[model samples]
Target: MSTEPVLPRVRPEIAALPPYRQGRAASADGFKLSSNENPFEPLPGVVEAVRDEVALNRYPDATAGQLRAALAVRYGVTADDVLVGAGSVSLIAAFLQAAAGPGDEVVYAWRSFEAYPSLTLVAGATSVQVPNRPDGRHDLPAMAAAVTDRTRCIVLCTPNNPTGPIITRAEFEEFLAAVPADVLVILDEAYAEFVTDPEAVDGLGQRVFASHPNVVVLRTFSKAYGLAALRIGYAIGDARVLDAARATLIPLSVTAQAEHAALASLARDAEVRIRVAELVERRDRLVAGLRDAGWDVPDSQSNFVWLPTTDPAVATAFEDAGLMVRPFPDGVRISVGEATSIAPLIDVAKSTILR
Candidate 1:
């Protein structure tokens, strides 16, 4: 006991926080559908572009000006209004750190993004989690009511992760009107490209920040553009707001390779959309098949479908069939993977869960 060494003290919150984990890996022959990832391979042009950025000896441009400019032009925003980071998650952390601190509060919907609670805690802020509706959509009015004077930021995940229903344009507009002007509203549209609903909120089309000025729209190349490995994403908001987030970023976190690849991907927007269309079609078929198999699947507008079942046997059935899916406390999220995966997934449901 006397010879025991003392370790450095860490914050209790930090000590208690469970580290973020990725989706479970699948077996060699299994179709990996746990992660809501683009099933397609990276475009040939994107691969070549990434390869061209081979000057590893040099530090990448910390500001990522080129990529920022490209994004700004596409969104009709100034370069100052755009801020790029390692990924949407990293950019979200930066924005949270910029606006919140000890004793402050961050408001978001529960059963939403897995990272929201961890991000809030890491930012030294309290998370005011509003429960989702029984239908699995965020209760927008309840979220607005949950806001207090202590709330510094609020995050809205459209076509919400895991559960794929989106906040409609009318719903969003009403919610925006109810929230205070000073509180930061983070519109996280990670799966925006997959949305087919005409009524879903379009942060860019509405020019939300133009009038509100408090809203920040976040998007990524990870989901639709298949640039997840590079971890590049960006935000669109007021210049001053984006500046705050920029200040909190780790230096040169966005690599040259990521920038080039994203730029190349953007140049082939038409081709990317074509791939996205294929995935969307697959998702619709999967949903229809699951519904026909007696699953109470939600009307998913994202690249994944939610199976509303807490039965362990359902998850076991999927695993046994060599298909990996993400199981939460209430349901499972199965990404629309290879076209071949659909038949096996539906077969498992019919053979086990539906029985």
Candidate 2:
């Protein structure tokens, strides 16, 4: 008999899926500009509120009722229309599970969110990745064309992660027109607070809900509210569709601490906007500096900028300059970090630019 150890059977797709890659952490003296995170500390009282309100001995509210009601009021929706989860990624996974199964197909833009592939695979659905345009925006027409009878869901990431370009409101309306009404469409807007472009699509308005019953909007406290550690996010959509997603939700995953922090953050919306405005200004300055230095940077409306280069040396150059940036196969994504980090980042760009 062979002496090889027996292994439990695992689904081939699950076995083959690579783990999600987090942005690289930097050394003590280095600036961590890899993760597109809000550089500011939490809003005043958020930490104190979480500390005071959390009941560690008891389970959290399974529905996150108060948070949902607050979000609904802000967005002019009913409480039933809001669904909370551990993160927007969890909401995506829940909606995918609700709408798709083995042999079904899910559609989204390529080079968008890194988690999309893993989420789809975990839901046992086939992925149809439509390529992004040269400017790093979604090719909505191609994505609409990719829909087939097996297609069950579609994801649209505005100011798409890692690349930082946005889908315009008009373009999104047209894209929605092209997509079948029955196919579920998710608008992932994790960086919505950082967006300064007036033309960028916003899925929070009531008009989108009134017109598109099949559409779902995902928002997170991670990026703007500086609540990444809490891992709380929510979705806005039709009650029936949200009901299906709720059915698929992992019970009580949204902790009481996260909910309290979100409420506290929401209470200080003005402060959040101020912080976001500062980041937007920093991003614009960084982009302008890179362009003036002869780098062909794309129009980034998010909290990060993308440098289109296939050369690994460029990323290494950033590392050498004490800045950690996220590098993809085709380019590198640098988050808008501290005011202090901007000069060094631009200096690196200037030095790395080819004549």
lDDT of each: 0.91, 0.92
lDDT of 1: 0.91
Model 1: lowest-lDDT 10 consecutive positions: 346-355
lDDT of 2 by residue, 3-96 (tens): 9999999998799889988889988988898988888899989999999999899999999999999998998889999999999999999999
Task: State TM-scores per candidate.
Answer: 0.98, 0.97
Runs off by more than 4 Å, candidate 1: 2-4
lDDT agreement of model 2 with the native: 0.92
